[model samples]
Target: VNRSATEIAEAIDYVGGILSVGAATDLSFVNVLVMRDSFDFAADLLAEIARTPVFEPAEIERQRQQVLSGIQVSLDDPAYLAGVVFGRLVYGLHPYGMPHNGTPASVRSVTRDDLRAFHEVHYVPNNTLLAIVGDIEAEPAFAAAERVFGDWTPRELPVSPNAELPAPTRRVVVVDKPGSAQTAIRVGHLGLARDSSDYLPFDVALKILGGEGGNRIGSVLRTERSLTYAASAEVVSRRFGGDFMAMADTRSDATAEALRLMVDEVARMQRERVSRRELENAQAYLAGSFPLTIEAPNAIAAQVLESLLYGLDLADLPTYPNRINAVTVDEIQRVTRAYLQPRQLSVVLVGEASAFVDDLVGVGFDDVEILSIDEIGPFLTRDDQVVSVDSFSPLLPLVP
Candidate 1:
C-alpha cells in the first residue's frame, strides 16, 4: 500500500480499471470501475487510496502547480470572471462566495501538514457513502465492501461551521476589459436549497425560463431580437443554499438591451401564468428523459446515490415521472412569485465599459461599480469598498 502515485496508476491500468477522485460542495468521492473479474482487486485499491492516502510531498507540489496553472488560464476567461464575481455578489462571505479552487495566495500556503489534518478529520467511515454498481449480486457486493472496509475505525466528525448568506440586493458591477467586442452578463438572485419542497416546481420554472424544455429567454434574445446567439437560465441547488442565474453574451453596443430583456423575461415569468402548452412541453421533456438517466448500470448507480445523498426517498425514484407530470401552472406561478426577485437581482457585466456604462442608467441600472479587469482580485478580497473613479483615467464616471 506504500506506493507512489505513478505506481497506483500503473496498477489500475494493469487491471483494466479506472480510478478517480473528485470534490463537490457537500461531498468528496473516489470512484472506481472495473470488469467483474477484477472487482476484488479494484475494491482493495479503492480502500487503500481512500483510507491511507500518503499526501506525498512531491505529488502534492505537482498537483498544486497544476491547479495554479489552471487558475491562471481561467483568469484570462471573461465568462469565468463573470461567474466568480457574480458568486461573490450573491453569497457574500459564505464559503460558497469564494472560488471552489483556492485562490492563488491560498493555494501557495497549503502545507503537507494541513492536508494531513484535513484528511484525518474528514476521511471517516461515518462520513462516507459507497455505491457499487455492475454485474454483481447485491449480497456479494455488500459482503465485499464489508470485508475491505469493515476494519476502518469510525471517528467523531467535526461540527460544520455555519455562515449566513446575504439577502438579495440590486447591485450592478461592470468589469472593464478594454477593446473587447462582446459583453458577458450574469443576472439573478438567491434560490432555495436542494432539499426544499419547492425544488421541483422551481426547477420546472427555470427550465421554461431558459433550459431545455422551453427557453423563453433564448426565444426573445436570440430568435426574436437577434441580440445574441445564446442565452439561458438555471437554478443551481446545493446542500445548504443555491442560486438562480440567467446568462448571455452580446455585442458591446447591445449589452444594455440584452441585459434589460433578460431581466424582463424573469419578471414576466413571475407576473403571468404560463400557457397550458408551455407547461406540457416542460413536463413532457422532464418525464420523458427520466428513463435515459438510469438506462445503464453506472447511470442507475449515479441516480440512486444522488437521491441518497440529498436524503430523498429511494422509493420515489420510480414515481419521478408522476411527480413531474403532476406539477401544475398554479404551482409554477406560486413558486416563482415566492422566490424570484426581479428588482433585487445581482448583475455582472464584463466588457468594454466605456461602450455601455453610459447606457446602463438609461436601461434602469443607475447605481453601478466599474472595476478594471486587473482590479478583480483585490475587489473580491475586500468587503464593499468602492474603487475610486480616478483609478481608471480613461473611463467615464465610476458610478451614476
Candidate 2:
C-alpha cells in the first residue's frame, strides 16, 4: 500500500515516455441562461476559465483512459456507430464531423504540448460570453460585471486554423459491416449556425419537418410510413453551422425503401405548398412546446448563456416564441423548398451494406465510397490535426 516516490515517478515517467504526448480536454460550459440584466452578468464572468490556470496532465491522463475504456465498451453499440458515421459523412472535411472520441492513433499522437497550445488558442477572456437572466436588473448586473470582469484585459487568441463551410453537394456513404442485423440510416444536408438570422426560421421550419407530434415529419414518418419504430428530422444547430438530419433505423431488408421514401418527403415539401392544416399543426406544436421547454432553471441559465454567446438581444427571448407563432404557411413551405433538398443531401447508413449499397448506386450516387472506421480516424480527431493529422507526418514511408 505504501509506494515509494520512485515508484510513482517511475509510473508517470514510463507512461509519459511510452506515449510521449499529453492531452488537454476543456469542455466549454456553454451556459444559456435567462435572467434580469444578463449583459451585466456576462461582464462579471468574462474570464471565468480564461484567466491564467495551471495545466493538469495527471487529470488529462485519467480522463483519457476513462474515455478509451468507454469507447472499447461501446464497440458493440450500434447506435454509437451510427451517430459517428453520420457526423463523418454529413460534415465531410468540416470540424463538426471531427471524430468526437479521439481515435487510438490520434490519442497516441497528442502531446502535452498540443493541449497547452490548444488552450492558448481557444481559452481567452474575450472569447468567452456570459448571459444571465430572471429577477435581475441591468444596472446592478453591469456593476456586478464590472466587479467580476472589469479589469479583464484583452488578450490575443491562439492562431487556430479555420473551418470553411463547403457548398452543399450530394453523395451516399455506407459503413458496410458484414453480418450486421439492423440498418441505421441518416439522410440530410448542412444548415445554419447559431448566429445566422436565417437560423430561427430554419429551426422552426425543421421542427415542422419532424420535431413535435403534429408536424409534417412526425406525422408522415411515424404514422404514415411506419417504416421503422420512429423517424424524425432535426437541424443540428451549433456555433458553427450544424446539420439538418433525418434519421431512422429500419430492418436491413427495408432500409433502402425507407431511405427513398424519406427523400420523397423532403422533396415533396420543397415542391409543394403546405396545406392549412399542416401550418396550424406546426404553429400549435411550436408555441405549445416553447414555454414548456423553459420550465427548468438549468434551461433558463442555458438560454441566457446562448443569447449572450450568440450576441442576441434580451428582447429576442419574448419575441422568439412570437416569431414562431407568426410563421405563415408560405414561410414554412418556402423554407422547406429552399433548404431541405433530397437531391442535395447525403445518404448515410450503418448496417448490412450489401442490402442497400447496390440499390443506392442505382438511385443516383455513382461515387459510392465504402468507408471503414479506420479510414476516417484522422478526420475525427479533436484538436491540432483537425484538418488532417497525417499531413503532419513525413511522406517518405507512406508513399514508398
Candidate 3:
C-alpha cells in the first residue's frame, strides 16, 4: 500500500505479471495475469491496488494531462466525433450519453478528494467479484482470495440514479467538418438491455442485419452498390440498457445515398422475414464461436465473469452452443418485430455538410440540424438550443 506507482509497476514486472485497471459504463475492474509460481504475490498486489489506491495529486495531474491529450486527438477524428454525437442522440440525458472520458472541463475539475470519496464508496468486499482462472484449484484459489481481501470491510452501496432513456425518434444531425473528404454515418436507436429474455434472438437478428454470420447491411451497401468500402451494424448491450448502430464511411458526395440505404436495410429487416438459409448461417456462427470464447484460461475467465456480472446462470455456459442452435427463424422474426424501431431512428453524419446537405432531401431526410465541429460541445451538453441549418452561420448557403 505504501509503494509508489513506479515501484508497483516494477514489482509486477519482476514477477512477469501484467496488471491493468479499466472502467466501463456499468463496472470497473482490475485484472492481473501471472504464472502459478507468482500467484501469492499477484493476489496481494491486486488487493493492494484495488483497496488502497493512493490517488496522489501529482499522479492524478499526470493522468489528467494524458486523458486531455487523448480528448484533443479524438476531436480531430471524424469517426470518433460521429460516434459521440450518436450516443448523445440515442441516450439523451442518460449517463450513457456522456463520454466515458470526462470532457476537458470535467476532467480539470476532478480533485484528489473526489477520487478518494469515490473509491471509498465503491471499493468494498461485498461489491466485488474475484475471478481466478488457470492452474489453480477451487479451494486454494478461494483461500488466496480470502487471505488478501478478508480484512476489507463492506459498505452499503448507494442506490444508482435512474433516468429515463429517450424514446427513439427520427432525427438527423450532421456534424459539419469542413474540408473533410469522407463522411462517417451512424444509424439506429435504443436496443434491449443485456438481461432481457429477448437478447439472444434479437442478437441473432442483429447479426443477420450487420454482424459476423450474416450481414445484409454490408451485402447491400458494400457488395451490391459499392457505396462505401465497409459497412456493418451491431447491438451494444450494457447492464441497464443498450443501443443498435449501423456505421459506414463513404465519400462526402455519397453520404445521403449511403445513409438512405443503411436506414432502408434496417427497415427491411423488420418488414421481411429472413430466409431460412440466413437464419441458419447466423445461428451456426454464434454456435461455432462459443467454443472459441472459452478456449483459453483468460478467455474462459471472461466468459465466466460476464455471466456472473450480468446475473446469468453459470450452469448455462456449457449449453451455450445448444441454446444458440435452438434459436429459430420464428424467434428471430419475433424479436425483430418486437424490438426493431426502424421508423424512429437517430442518425449522425459527420463530414463536409455542404457536399451532401442539399441531396439529403431527395433521400427523405428534410429536417436536418447542422453543427460545426466547434459547436458540438455545447450541442451535446446544453438543452433547448437548436443549431438548425438556418441558425448555423457556416451553412448559410443551404438555408437560403
Question: What is candidate 3's lDDT per residue for 175-247, written digit by digit as tens?
Answer: 9998999999999899988888899899989999999999998999889999888898999997778999999
TM-score of 3: 0.94
Clashing pairs in 3: none
**Per-model CA lDDT versus the true structure:** 0.84, 0.62, 0.83
RMSD of 3: 8.6
Clashing pairs in 1: none
- Among all windows of ten consecutive residues in candidate 3, which has the lowest summed lDDT? 391-400
Q: Which is the better candidate, 1 or 2, if ranked by lDDT?
A: 1
Look at candidate 1 and tell me the lDDT of residue 331. Answer: 98
lDDT of 3: 0.83
Return the candidate ranking by TM-score, descending: 3, 1, 2
TM-score of each: 0.94, 0.77, 0.94
Instruction: List candidate 2 segments past 4 Å from native.
Output: 1-27, 30-52, 132-148, 158-162, 215-218, 361-367, 378-400
**How many angstroms is residue 39 displaced in model 2 relative to the true structure, after the best TM-score fit?**
18
Candidate 2 global TM-score: 0.77
Q: Candidate 2's residue-wise lDDT over 106-137, tens digit each?
A: 66667678867766655555665544444656
